[model samples]
Each structure stands twice: as C-alpha cells, then as structure tokens.
Target: MTARWKPNVTVAAVIERQGRYLLVEEQCPDGLRLNNPAGHLDPGESPAAGCARETLEETAHHFVPTALVGIYMARTLQPLEGQSEDVTYLRFAFTGTLGEFDASRTLDDGIVRTLWMTIEEIRASVERHRSPLLLQCVEDHAEGRRHPLELLHVDPSVAGAP
Candidate 1:
C-alpha cells in the first residue's frame, strides 16, 4: 500500500512590536534561512498552544497567540536529505502578542538567533525565507488580518486521544 498522505498542520507566530516584526534565523537544509517562529503541531495541543511553544523554543519569547491571522496551505518542492526525492508541507499561520523574553531559555537546535525586521526589510529578503508563507504571514498580519482565538476549538476527546 502507498504511504498514507497528510498535509502537515503547522503554526507560525507573526509577532509585531514597535514597528518591527519578530523573526528567527535558523539553519535549514538549504542553508541559513529566516522565518516566523513556527513548528509542527504536537499531540494534545491546540494551534495556539503550538505557536506559543514554538515561539518560546525558537526565540525564547513568551508568545501569546491572541489571534488567528490566517490559515495557509503551502507546497514546496524540496529535495530530501540523503535521498533522491522531494517533499512539501502545509502551514497554518497566526499573529499575536509577544510577551517578555526569557533569557534563561536555549533556542532549538539549528536556530541561531532572533531579531526584529521591518516590513520593508522582510519584503526585500524574499530569497532568505524557508517558504513563501514567511512573507505572506507577515503581510497578512500587517493588513489587519485577525480571527478570534476561539475559532480553533480543541475537542477534549480528540486532544487526549492516544
């Protein structure tokens, strides 16, 4: 049988403060890349929770996912490592408040540093993004795109399923 196929549901944090947006510089297979603090949804957590956790892991910042900026589906043809193959992903993006930074925390592996970038700067670095959604997330956020946090409900039974 062919392997079961499913698009990866992920969350991204588009954190803006003082005219700049938060971004993380990380090492991807393609080389150094920039992106919103994001990661795959883990078991037993809501999308907001996933964004909060990923933000902390990637940037050491307390992330409060206050709004759902948008739901995004992205596909990229990327060569798999150590194999003659390609892969893709579907990302869900969110925008919210960035709280206090925790200096004691360590960033995730392959993550180098976190910085703030203005929209113009972000637009100019299109080539540095891990995927097109990087800039799209930010643009949507800048356009006042927002959804009530309650739009995503975590069914307790499904959440707790093993």
Candidate 2:
C-alpha cells in the first residue's frame, strides 16, 4: 500500500517594528539559515495560538497574532533518504504586534540569534533563507495582505487544556 500523504502544518510570525522585520538565524542541515519565527504546529492549538507560542519560544518575545498574513503551500522537490513519501508544508503565517522581550529567557536551541532586517537586505540574501516561505511571508506582510483571524476556525473538540 502507498504511504498516506500529508503536509506538515506550521505557523509563523511576521513581525515588523519600524522599517525592519524580525528574523531568526538558526542552524539547519544545510547550514545556518534565516527565517521568520516559526515552527511545526503542536498537537492541539489554533494556528494563531501556535504562532504566538512558537514566536515566543524561538525569540523570547511576546507575540500577539492579530491577523492572518497568508496560507502558503509548497512541496519539497527532493526528499532526504529514508523518506516514505513526498513532503509538503502548509504554512499559516501571521502578522502581529510584538510585546516585551524577556531578556532573562533563553532562546530555543538551534536558534543562534534574532535580528531585524530591511526588505532590501532580505531580498539580497535569499540564498541564506531557510525556505522560500521566509521571503514570501515578509513580502506579503509588507504589501498589507492580511485576513481576519476569524478565517480560521478551531473546533472545541481539539482544544487541549491550556
């Protein structure tokens, strides 16, 4: 039988303060790469809530996801060995206001540092991006592309205890 197909679900925070966008420099299989504060969705949480949690964990900052930036779907052109099937990603990107930084908190492992970058700078270094979604999400955020949080409905059945 063919292996069941599924896309990885992820959430990201596209946070912009002043003219620079927030990004995380992290270690990846290929090398160190830049990406928005993002990660896989946990077992039981709304996409917005997932974004908020991931942003905080990865950056040590409070992020309140106010709007959905966009839904992105991309397939991996090549799969690493030992994979059972093609891999795709369903990314829920959000635009939000960042709150107080917890300097006392430690950033997630594999996260080297968090830095702010201008759009031009981001565009110039596409080679260093962790994924294309990194730049696409930022560009969409800069273009005023946002949908109401209501667009995503989280059923109560899957709402795990906080």
Candidate 3:
C-alpha cells in the first residue's frame, strides 16, 4: 500500500486584544514569515491543549481558547530550494483570551519575536505570511463565525479520541 496520506494536524490560536491580533514572527522553511501562534498537534493532546502550548512556546503567553473560529483545508504550492510539492493543510483555528506573558520564559527556536498588529497590518504583510491560512483565520474571526467549544468532544474511554 502506498503510505496512507496523513497531513499534519495543526492548531492555531487567534488571540485578539484591544484592536490587534497576536502574531509570531518565525523562520519557516520558506523564509522569515508571520503566522498566528500555531504548531503541529502533539501526541496525547487535544487541539485546545496544542493551541495553548504553541502560544506559550512561541509568544511566552498563556492562551485560553474560547471558541472555534472554523476549520480550513488549504492546498498550496510548496517550493523547497528546487524540490516542490503540492501540500494541503487541515487547520483548526480557535479564538480566545490572551493572558499575560512569562518574561522569564524562552521562546521556541526560529521564533524571533511576537507582535500585536491590526488586521490591516496583517493584510498588508500577506506576502510575508508563512501560510495563506494566517490571514484566513483572522478574517473568519473578524466575521464572528465561531463554533462553541462543545463542538469537539473527547471520549474518555479513548485517549486522543475527538
């Protein structure tokens, strides 16, 4: 059997405060780009947990996911030096409360800094975004299309079952 195709599962936190969104400036495979606090879902953790963890790791802030913005399937051309592939991503985005940061904490590798930028600013920097979903999540958030947390139910009998 050709290896079963399984796209990496990622979780992103759309943390907004005042009138700006929290963004992480990191060095992706493409280049130095902007993206929400997002990361691959770790084993034995729910999407919410992953979002919280990624936010803390990238921005040194605690994020409490309040609502699911929406799910997205985005396919794009991926070019690596010379080897390119068509990659599809399944992203779970959540909007929530952005708590205080831990100044003592160290940011993850490749993460240069975090910034709070207005949606317009983000839009202007679309060319620098690591992925297209970076702005899509923000747009969906601005539209107020959120699903309740209850939309995801983890069965107690099985670990990592949602």
For this target, which candidate reaches the highest TM-score against the unseen true structure?
1
**Superposition TM-score, candidate 1 onto the true structure:** 0.93
- Candidate 2, overall lDDT? 0.91
Best-matching candidate per lDDT: 2
TM-score of each: 0.93, 0.92, 0.92
Per-residue error for 149 in candidate 3, Å, reads: 0.6
| Candidate 3 runs further than 4 Å off | 157-162
Point out where model 2 deviates above 4 Å: 77-86, 160-162
Each prediction's Cα lDDT score? 0.87, 0.91, 0.89
Relative to the true structure, candidate 2 reaches a TM of: 0.92
Cα lDDT tens digits for candidate 1, 1-162: 899878888899998888799999999877899999999999888888899999999999998888899998877766466553444566767777788889999999999999999999999999999877999889999999999988878788757764
- Which pairs in model 1 have colliding backbones? none
Pairwise TM-score winner, candidates 1 and 3? 1
